[model samples]
Target: MNSIKQTCKNVKTLVDSFLNSTTPIFCTPTDEPKDTEAWYSTWEDNYIGDFLNNSVVKAGLKKIADFYCAKQLDVLLRHSSELKASSYPQLYRIYKECCKRLGFVKMPKLYITYQIFGINALSLEVKGHKLILLSRMATIRLNEKELRFILGHELGHHQQGNLVCHTVNGLLDTFNTSSEIFGPMISDTIEVPMKRWCRQSEFNADRAGYICCGDIDAVTNLFLKLGMESVCSAYNEYKELEDAHPHLQTRFTELKKIHKTIKVNR
Candidate 1:
């Protein structure tokens, strides 16, 4: 109990220090972001890099990815169907076009699952193979522009080298670390930074969606629906800090800012 408390206190201190700095302390900062989209500078610079330099954290993250990636691939093979350019030519064409427009040279293996029930998508790298899982709900509900946004967002994670998604991909496998140190490691180092990075990373991804699709309304609507923002505003608080992603309103507002900038620049 004391250890957890102390660890959280220490993390808070580091967070404060990072937030106060002009530059983040990450080892490999995105020196040149491939996507010319905007960045959430304050959040990214503060919360997105400590784990990159930590050996213990890296080991734990790798363990999670290795353990779960294969299983996820296996499960997808069983439950999800791959959308190939040969089999689904039109969809494949769209995928290719999205990659071309987004400046993503390499395409990730893409899959779509039925009855997904949620408007969601995921990007992960398994055994050096990058993959994107686009849910059926997204296909049904989101327009082509919105689809471009979703695709761009997922691909953006790849561009950002989103290491944490590798860790998150394993979450469904009942995350139990093989090493005993992992528990302490989580409490001691990984938890808070991971939370912040995951959230901050979403900003960069959203920028990708906005830039690639070039439609703020579509992007904003996707976020608004995903968070059930209307429902939340009526019943729940405007924002929930515990969420891995930012509030829908916050995301939409940020997109609006981007829209304003684009308009002014034009």
Candidate 2:
């Protein structure tokens, strides 16, 4: 109990120092090569490189090319509340600040929808229109830095060229509904590999989150909110084969390792 209290105290001290300091202590959008080349998870880069080249994935992409239609209108017009500087001043500031710090050439639209519980956030690029969607619970529960982490993580998908692959997964889910026709075919060619790649992609995004939030303690705290600190087992790995996101513990461990390396280098 004392250890936990001490840790929290330490984290609070670090966060206060970070916010109060004038100098930039972490990488900013100006840090050249404004893309994942700077901070991509090496394993994720290699895996995605191979995943993109696979003849099956290439063929699947061709088949699903037409499904990349923009849905920003549907989200904006029919579903969620859009965040704009004129309206949601504070939240919008955080969104824009994250975009600038993350090196996004064009700011993506941000939107939020009601959700009673649980944090939810996602980003997508459809026909060149990019947007980030978040559950209202996220804005209500997370602090500004944690929110930056979420936005940065989502934007990282675009930075790392994972959007098309993500779109493929979304389309696959839609196709799975009519599994009698598309199941065996997609399951054989694209499903598992795509899911595996998507899980790995989270590591890349976590790195982006770390860079954007500029606070490891805040990142881990966000993970705690997501219930990702539990132990992971072999069974968890097997079950995660077709999961889009990795286990919380696995993600926490991976990010911790990354944060250690980043600290040493800095």
Candidate 3:
């Protein structure tokens, strides 16, 4: 535990140094041409590079990614319903707008599944293939701008190599079936930092969402509606390390700071 905390601290120090030296802003004018070349240098989360370079994290991710991808593709083809522009024009338009703003030349395939309860969204990558999945409940519950924020957040995951985080998560979901095999393969060294990186990836995605929608109020209202405030207040550092996402409080607070930065820069 002490070593994990120390590692986190070291990572924080490096992140702080990187942020100090770079402009951590993504709220650019959409009218300008997509600056794909400058995307990583100008707007990427500093933590992504650090975590991706970690040998243990990379090995663990590589081990599970192909298997997870095959599993997900099977589920997508067999179980999930995909959304196309011909049938879902409004939703497709919003997705296209996000892709354009993010400068994605190759659009990801989009899929949706109906759920009796809960609102959720996720993105996946298999090798170079990218995909985004949205719950029908999410589409029904969120307004257009809020929906854009959600979609953009998924896109954010793809943009920053955060896709591997999803592979880890998917592997966990199937732990009952695969645990005997995977449990031996993934060690604490790999799992701990990978989880830490998972949490950090949310910040990057939130920024992408903000960039896509350009509406801080929509972002705030959506999070509040998701009940972030009630759940986040009680969360602690230890709990945060175990969880895949940052406390809603942490995410919203960071978004608010980014909002302020956007205002000042504009």
Candidate 4:
């Protein structure tokens, strides 16, 4: 029993380390339009473009559009003192608009650190504080539009503080550390559903990002770039999970569909 307990502890440590090392996969946009143009051209020449132009993509995009409309610029900036008062007023306005549309009321405390390994953004709902950490490496490289979208994505998690569900999910993850008798059963009963829900949440957040950025094209481009970067990264193994967030092409397609459908209905 003591040995079993020790083994469980070791497994927990290993799992935690694995999770911590995994960074939020995202791509930093190039500062120059020419650079972006070149990359875009290359991407379009590749398979991603083919995936984006598919019927399934169109359907997904339409689903997002039907669910929510784009947010207004003024309403978005109401809580953002730093952004509203900045020289880049337009950028801040865009950010605020996305937040408003997504009904993101609370601002998570932002932390930056070079020491953090793997992830780009983390949203933690602790006892009293909702904390968000953005990777300095990721943030320093993003264009204004990309930055706002990423921030809005984190805000999406903040708004989704359905505590009971989160707590249950956490407990299940912990319990599945060992116990061969219960491990596979618990994973199937809990982890699968949790991951599916998380993926759905990502779609919602992507919609929020498009609304905040005020440009589906920008959002799609950013997604494509990020996907490429993810594929290039050492942590690219996460992408191998069929159950992870929908493929990048699917997401981009969904966004496009949302934009088109909303425009038609409006």
Writing each residue's lDDT as its tens digit, candidate 1 over 135-252 gives 9788778878778888878877877766445465236223325556555566335555555666777777777766667776677677767763544463334334534577667666
Give the higher-lDDT candidate: 1 or 2: 2
lDDT of 2 by residue, 127-165 (tens): 456767888899989998899889878877767766667
TM-score of each: 0.69, 0.71, 0.70, 0.53
Give the candidates in order of TM-score, highest first: 2, 3, 1, 4
Candidate 4 ranges with C-alpha deviation above 4 Å: 1-105, 116-119, 162-174, 229-244, 261-266
How many clashing residue pairs appear in each of the predictions shown? 0, 0, 0, 12
For candidate 4, write residues 1-266 as lDDT tens digits: 46444544453454445434544224468653220011101111322223223433323332332223223212322322332325445544645655555555544555554544433665554433555555656555677778777776666655644322333345556677767787786565446655555555566656555545666656766676565343333344355242435666655655676655332110
Ranking by lDDT: 2, 3, 1, 4
Deviating ranges (above 4 Å) for candidate 2: 1-41, 44-77, 115-117, 173-185, 263-266
Segments in model 1 whose C-alpha atoms lie over 4 Å from true places: 1-43, 53-60, 165-189, 224-227, 230-239, 262-266
**Residue by residue across 1-266, what tens digits does model 3's lDDT show?**
57545654564565455444544323446664432521421334444456665655544454457554777577665666777888888999999988878778777888887632467887777655687878888888999989988898888888776577567665654562467765533434346455666776788788878878788889888988777764443448567877678887788887787565542111
Flag regions of model 3 displaced more than 4 Å. Answer: 1-51, 54-63, 115-117, 169-188, 234-237, 263-266
- Candidate 1 at residue 216, lDDT? 68
